[model samples]
Target: MEEFFNELFDYNFFCNKQLIEACSDLKEVPKESMRLFSHILNAHQIWNARINGLESEFGAWDEHPLKTWEEIHYENQRNTFEIITNTDDYETRIDYQNIEGRLFTNTIQDMLFHIINHSTHHRAQILADFRANGLEPVSLDYVFYKR
Candidate 1:
């Protein structure tokens, strides 16, 4: 299970880095893309903090400058890897409050997978925004990343 989650996270990291590089090279990244990508980074950090029983410094919709994306992303990836490494049971339940202050409980496995799924969901939105803004979207399919 650890191996599987680690591979998924590695793939997630790759796709995010690709998107960051693509946006960084643009003369001006689209407004919506910037907002969506920043949300992506923020959400990942928030999830990691939740799993570690720590307070998150970012809000759900907080916008970060492009220059800070990579640093935040690296930290998120490192923290997730640490979580996966230290976890003895993927099925261990975690109780956390949402940004809405609502209490919820989920297994470590579910939360880890949610991070990847949530990022993919938002990345697709950002890619669509890129296309609408006349910018070419990079391919981020998992199959392509594996090859």
Candidate 2:
């Protein structure tokens, strides 16, 4: 599971960089796309922090604007790599509080999988925004990354 997540994180970072580079020259993109991408990263960070028993830096969704794209992507790469390298025991479980302050325990493996799946879902929306803005979207399918 750890190896699988490591590969997925690497693939995700590669694809994210490609998408950013592909749209580098675009004068404008839908603000919502940028917002959503940042939201994904922030959510991941918040969840990670919670699982690690650290205080979350981000408040409720209404409390902060999604971070800038460059910032989010940079931190995403950093955090994903940290997660891959620092986590060795897939069975290690952590207690976490949800948005509603409900507490539960989950394995590190499950949390890592959730982060990747969450990002994939939102990246599709970002791609749609690329097309809507007349920009060519990068191929971000997992199969494309695998091949």
Q: How close to the true structure is residue 60 of candidate 1, measured as C-alpha lDDT?
A: 94
Tens digit per residue, CA lDDT, model 1, 20-138: 99998999999999999999999999999999999999999999999999999999999999999999999999999999999999999999999999999999999999999888899
Per-residue lDDT of candidate 2, residues 1-147 (tens digit): 657877888877777676666556556656766666666767777766765678877653422233355566677568766776887787889988888989899888888788778878888988888888877777887788778
Ten residues in sequence with the least summed lDDT for candidate 1? 129-138
- The residue-level lDDT of candidate 1 at 6 comes to 94
Over 4 Å off in model 2, which ranges? 59-68
Best by lDDT: 1
Name the runs in model 1 displaced over 4 angstroms.
Answer: none
Candidate 2 to native Cα RMSD, angstroms = 2.8
